[model samples]
Target: MSLQDKNIAMLYYGEQPHPAHTGFADAIGADFICCNPRSDGSKIDSPLNEFFNGFSLPDYDIYITEGSRPLYSGIAATIFSDSNLIYLGGDHRLRELSLGGFPNQAQTDTRYLRTRSKILQFLCQHFIDGAIAVSADSATFLQQLFGSPSTVRTAKPYVQRDVFKSLSTLSTDLESKKVAVIASANRGNVGDYKGIDMLVDSWPDVRNHFPDLKLEIVGKGHQAKHENTEGVRVKGYVEDLDTVFESIGLYVQPSRLEVFGVSVIESMVAGVPPLVTETTGASSELKGIEPALVVDPNPESIASGIVQYFDRTVAERENIAKECREYAMSFSPDVRTKIFHEEFKSLIDEIQ
Candidate 1:
C-alpha cells in the first residue's frame, strides 16, 4: 500500500488535545481521537479502566500517542501489540530530574511514579515499534532508560510562530535590562522545577551589576509568592503575549528539568535573546548561536548570565536578538509538522 493509503490515528487521553498531536494528524492525514473521561462517572482505576470511558479504539494501521504513564498510552500498546505503535517520548523519571523539592516534594509518594515509569519502559522495549522525542536528550533517555529497541529520532515540538513572533521591529532601545521568566505553577509549586526561586535569588545579584535591570514573572499562580520580591513584577496570567513580548528585553527559562522549553523559542521568535539552563532542551538552540547565554541551574550561574547579556553593547545585543529570531524560525509548527509527517511515513513504509 502507498504511504498515503495507510490508516493512522493519534490516541490521546486528556481534557484537551495537544497541538503537536493534532498538528501531526493533520499533516499526515490521520484521525485524532480524544480518549477523555466519560460523563458516566467512570473512574480510571487502571489502564484497562481508562479505556472504559465510552471510546472504542478505532481501527488504524498505525497508532500514535504521548509516551509516559502506563494509564495514558499503555492500553493502546497492549491491545495493538502486533501493529505499529509510535510513542512521542518527552517525559523523564522524577528522580532523574531533581532531589526532593517543589512538585517532587519531601513527602510525595514514589511507588506509583516509579511503577508507572517501569510499566512504560516495559511497553517501550516490548510493544512500541517507533519513538520520537521532543529533544535529543529525551531521545537518548527513551533509548537508554526506557529501553526502546527501535531507532529513536529527535523532532522539535510544534510552536506557533506567528502568534509569538515580534509584532514590531526588533530593537535594543526598549529597556534592554528588562527580563521575563514565563512558567506555569498550576500543577503544584513548580518553583523548584522551573527555578523561579533561584531566578528571584539571582535578581538581586543581577541588579548589583545592572541596577536598572527588571524581572517580570509571567504565568498562572506564579506571582503570589514573588509579588514582593525586589525589582520583580509578577504578571499572574497574561491573555495576550504579543504585548508582553513587546516589552521583554531578555527571556529566561531556568527550568531544572525541561524536556523542551517551548517558551524559550517563542521568546526568541519575538526577537528576544534567552538565558536558559544548560540542561534544558532548548539550550541546544541557544548554544549554537551564543553558547555563553546557556547557564547552569543555579542562582550564581543565572545571575552571571543575566549580567553578561546586559553588559553587551546595544548593537551587539541587537545582533544577538536578530540571530535568535532567525534561528527560531526553523522550530515553528509548520516546519515540525512536516518533519513529523516524514518521520511517520518512514515508519509506515518500514512496516509495509
Candidate 2:
C-alpha cells in the first residue's frame, strides 16, 4: 500500500481535522493525494492545491469528491482529468444536471438553481462513477437526484483515540458540581437553537432540586448575562476543550437539528454524561449507554432530566461515567479507520 501504488485523489472543502486523518491513512500506503481549494491560508495551507498546482492527476486510480454542492463543483472539472470518479456524498444538483433535469418553475428563478445548474454541468462532463453518502437521508436524496450506485450509512469519521485520551485526563469527581455545554453561540439565539434559553428558563426549577449545580457554557455566541443565576458561567471559544471538559459533570445539547453531534461524542469521550435531543445523531448511537439522557428541548423536560441525574448517588454516577467512557471508545480512530478502509475498498470495487 505504498503512497505511489494507491494513486487516489481526494476532493474536499478544506483540510478539516477528520478528513485530514483519512488523508493520512491513504497517504501511508496508497497513492493518496488531496485537494481542498476552499481552505483559506488563515487556518491551514491547502495541501492538495499546493501539490497539484503544477502536478497532473490522470495517473490516479480513483478520485473521491468529499461532499456535495459548492465544494464538489471545484472538483467536478477534475473528474474528466481522472480515470474514475466517486462522490463521497451525493450531489443533488450534479445528479440532476447530469441527467439534464431542471427544477420546478418556482425554483428556476432563484440564484441557487442557476449555480446548481453550472455545478451539474461540470459533474455531467466529468462522468461520475458513484457516490457514498454518510446518512440514509443523504443517500436517498442522492439516489433521487443522481441515481444510486452503492451506499453505506456510517457516522462521519472522527478522531476517537485523541478525544478519548483527552477525556481520560479530565477530573470526573461529581462533587465538582460542574455542568457544561459546548456549542457555537452565533448559530442561533441562545433561546432558539442550542436550547441555551431553554436551559436558562429551566434553571430555576433545576436549582430548586439541585442548588449546587454550576454551569459552564463553552463556545462563543451572543448570550445575555443573567444576573440572578448563582453558578452559571460562560467560557467562550476555549482553546483547550479537554481542560474545559475536566470540571464538568454533564454535557447538554438542545439543538433543534444536527446532522451528527460531534460534541456529544466528545463529551462521552471526556467521561461526561450527555443530556441531548433525540434528533441528534449521537442520540441513536448513545442509546442504552447509561447516564446518557435524552429529552425534548422544553424547559420542563431539560430540568427534569438534569434533576434525575443529580439525584444519583456518587457511586452510581461513577458507574454511569464508566459506561460512557467504554461506549465512547467504540468510535475511536482505530475502529473508524477500519470501517473507512472497508467501505472505501467496497465502494471502489462496486464503482469499478
Candidate 3:
C-alpha cells in the first residue's frame, strides 16, 4: 500500500509545471512530465481531453494531476483507466467553504464559470481517490466537497526561498511608505477575483491617513483604471519580484477568491509583512503568525488593516517583518519535500 516502491507520474498540461506539482513529484519520486494536450492550447475542452487528443499517457501505479475533468459532453473515463488518480486541488478555488450552498457574488457573476464549478463539484463528490490541498482552508473545502475528511491531505507549494527571501535588512523608509499588490488586473475574471478595483479604491483613504504612502500595482493586463489614481504606480509584470519585495514595506492581497496567494508567500519570504483577506487560502498561514493582518475582503476593512500596519512604530513593523520571513522559511522547497514525502506516504497508505 505504500508509495515507496510504486511507480508515480505527475502530468500537467502546459509548457511549465507548477511548483507544487514538481514538489509532489519529488516527494514521491514520480516522473514529472510537461505535456501539451492541445496544439493550439484553447480552453474549449478540459486538459484531460486535450491530453488524450495528442499525447499517449504512459502507465504508472499512481497518476497525479490538477483537479480537472472532461465536461458532461466530453470524454470521461478513458484516461487513467487503471491507475489511482490523485487530484491536486490546491490551485483552484472552490466557493468559500463558509458560504455553503449560498450564492456569493463570484458564484453569480458568470454563467460559464458557474457551470464549470458545478462540474468540478460533481467530480469531487463522485471521483478521485484522494485530493491534495495546499492550505488548511483549502483542505477544509476539499474535505467538504469530497464528503470524506480522510481523503483530503494538506501539502504546501514549493517556494524558492533563496530567490524570494530578503537579501539584506529591509529599509524602514522604503517599506513603511509603500505597499504592493501583485495580482493581474485584466478585466473580468482576473481583475474581479483579485479585487484589484477594491484595492485601488481603498488606496486613497489609506493615503489620506499617510500622505506619503504609495501603492504599487504589479502584474499585467490593462491597468488604465489605476492611471489617474493618486499615489498609485502600475508596474506591469516585472521580471524582478525580489527587487519589488525589497523596495516595499508591506504587501497586500485583497483577493475575493484565491486558492492560495503565491505572491503573499513570496512577500513573506522576502521579510515583508503581508495583509491578506480572510478568504485568501494563505490566510491560514497568516492567522497563526499575526491574526490582525487577515482582514475582511472589502475596501474599508482592507484600508483599515493597512492603516493599522502603518500605525505601528518602525521597530514594531520590523519585528513583524522578521516573523513573516521566519514563518515562510518553513515552506522552502527542501523542507516541504521532506515533510510531504512522509505525509504523502501516510495519505496514500490510508487511501489504499
TM-score of each: 0.83, 0.67, 0.83
Sequence-dependent TM-score of model 3: 0.83
TM-score of decoy 2: 0.67
Which stretches in model 2 have alpha-carbon errors above 4 Å?
1-6, 14-61, 78-149, 153-156, 160-162, 184-198, 221-231, 297-300
Q: Which candidate, 2 or 3, would have the higher TM-score against the true structure? A: 3
Full-model lDDT for every candidate: 0.70, 0.60, 0.72
The residue pairs in collision within model 3 are 175-249
**Ten contiguous residues minimizing lDDT sum, candidate 2:** 98-107
Candidate that would win on lDDT? 3
All candidates in order of lDDT, best leading:
3, 1, 2
Weakest lDDT window of 10 consecutive positions for candidate 3: 69-78
Clashes (backbone N, CA, C under 3 Å), per candidate, total: 0, 7, 1
Error of 3 at 194 (Å): 1.6
> How many backbone clashes can be found in candidate 1?
0
Off by over 4 Å in 3: 1-4, 33-48, 51-56, 67-80, 96-122, 164-175, 184-191
